[model samples]
Structures are given as C-alpha cells and as structure tokens.
Target: MCEDEKSLLEKAKNGDVFAYESLIEGYQKKVFNLALRMVGNREDASELAQEVFIRVYKSLKGFKEQSQFSTWIYKITTNVCLDELRKRKNRNITSLDEEIKLEDSEIKRQIEDDKPTPEMIVEKNELKKVVSDAIKLLSDEHRTVIVMRDIQGFSYEEIARIINCPEGTVKSRLNRARLALKEILKGKAELLSYEFVK
Candidate 1:
C-alpha cells in the first residue's frame, strides 16, 4: 500500500468513517465486478459488495497487513458471494439463465475494439453471452477460479492468497476450471468458434 492508503487504513481502523470510505473508494468497482461475476446478478452483486465493506470495516483491526489490502478485500468479496450462493443453492434458486446486466462502460471494456461492423458487434455480444452462460454452469470452485484468474485478471499468487490455498493448488484448480469451461463451451462451438476452445 502507498503512504496515503496506509494513512487512510490507520484512520479507518481507528473508527474514522470518512477515512474508511476513502480507503474503499478505489476498490468499490473491483469488488462489485467480482461479486457480479460470482453471483451473476447486478442487484445481488451490489448488496454483496456492501456486505464485503461492512465485513472489512468490522475486521479492520485484525488485518495484519500480511497481504496487499486489495487481496484481502477480494478475499472478503469472494467469501461473501460464496456464502450467498450457498444460501441460494439451499433454497433451490438458480440463476443460470438470468441475464447479467453490464453497463455500457463495462461492455466497452469487455470488447475494446474501437471500430467494428454491425455483424462483428452482434457476433461479439453472442459470444459474450455464450461464454458467460458457460461460466455460470461451472461448479462453485471452478467458477471462482475462472472468474478470479481469467475474467478478473488476477495473478496466480494473488488468487492463491485470496482463496487461502497453495500456489500449486491454485494453478491446478485454474487448469481444471479452464478445462471445465472449455467443455461447457463446446456445446456452443458454432457461436464460440475454435479460438475460445483453445
């Protein structure tokens, strides 16, 4: 953490609400994104992100600074989302076909091409939906690893820390997750093409 963030963390630990808000400002979007990917719903993801901050604030003093604060926050995020998923599972609520609402900005970020023909745009959107549906079909462990490493661009070390696992475990889990995702996407080979399969 940088000096400013270190100072804010200290103040937040001491019960300064503004400092806590400032400390979490940079992470809000990332937390929301992670939660969204995990839960596949915007409203639930927003609530989960709030829960993550609440947990972080309550556990602020216990944080020993052993890992990057961002990693710690992500850990909290994944835990909160997973807990919600478990609850949903127990209630027999599944959101596999629910459309994940991404804002225009997020859509642009996912597809960075500045210029594209209408056909290309339609194809990209179809591929995006197909891939997202495939990801949702993965088991929780597989989905989490896929979201963290592939979608969110977290390094293996960061993912290992976030998931509280050995680095080798993280790598193996990610490999398996990718294979599982590839298998899921295979059914939609016409839409995804060989590029995604590889």
Candidate 2:
C-alpha cells in the first residue's frame, strides 16, 4: 500500500465516514471495472459494487491490518461477484448478454473515442463478442480466476486470498482456464491459439 492509502485506511478504520468515502472515491472505478468485466452486466456490476462497499463498511470494525486494505476490499468484491454469478446459475439466468452491453451513453462515448480507427473499433467489438461468449462458457470458478488474474491484473497470491484458495491452486486453475478459453475461442486468435500459453 502507498503511504497515502495507508493513512486513508487508518482514518477509515477509525469510523471516519468521510475517510471511507474518500477511499471509495479513490478505488471505486477499479472495483466497478473488475466487477463489470467479471460479471458481464452493468446493472449487476453496479449493484455488486454497492454490495461490496456495504460489506466493507459493515465489516470494517473487524478488519485486521495484516494485509493491504486493497487486498481485503478485493476479496470482498470477488466474493460478491462470484456469489452473484452463483445465484444466476441457480436461477438459470444465463444468456443475459444484453445486460452486459454499455447501456450508459457516457461510457460508450468514452469507449468510442478511445478507439482511434474504425478498424480498431470493429476489431474491439468482435474481440469483445468472442471474449464475452467464451467467458459465458467457463465454469464460475474458472471464469473468476481468469477475471482476477488476466483481466484485473491481480497477483496470483492476491487472487488466492480473494478466492480462498492456495496459490498453487490458483495457478493450476488459471492454466486450465487459459487452455479452455483458447480452445473455445480457437480461431479468434490471429497468431496463435492454445499454444499461446506455452
């Protein structure tokens, strides 16, 4: 943790709601982005982000200072996202890809402007479709691991804590997840496929 975050976390831990809000302001986008990508649903991600914060706020009193505050919050968010996915499975709520589209005009505008060329935009859309479809094919466990590691850039150890698994287990699951993803989206890769892992 950075010195600034350490100070902010200390204040938040002391029941300072302003400090907590400040911390949220700093990390909100990242948390939301991770949840959005993992769950592939904007509304679900937004709701889950709220739930993650509520969990953080309610559980703040019990927070031990042993780990990075970010790590703890990530663990909370991960469980929340995975829990939502599990509930979807239980309800047979698959095929909700329309829920994942950028419904917010502002975000879509940003996304569009960020794409420098029409070709890039088309490629991105195509890639997004492929990835989204492939993600839907993954079991929740493999999907979450890939989201945390590949998309969200969490360290394997951080993911281990978030998912309550051993680091070796995280690595193994990630390996299998990569293989499965490559297999599912085999023809999409330009230069390689499953061998990209090696």
Most accurate candidate by TM-score: 1
Best by lDDT: 1
lDDT (C-alpha) at residue 173 in model 2? 84
- Residue pairs with clashing backbones, model 1: none
Worst 10 residues of 1 by lDDT: 103-112
Candidates' lDDT values, in order?
A: 0.80, 0.73
* Cα lDDT of model 2 by residue, 1-198, tens digit: 667767877888888888889877867988997888778878988999999998998888788877767888888988898889878867877643222222221111111123233244246566676677567666677788888888888899888888888999999889877766765566445423433566
lDDT per residue for candidate 1 within 1-198, as digits (tens), equals 999999999999999999999999999999998998888879999999999999999999999886789999999999998999889877878633332223210111122224343355358776686677667767778789999988999999999999999999998888877876776566545435556556
Model 2: runs farther than 4 Å from truth? 1-7, 95-122, 187-198
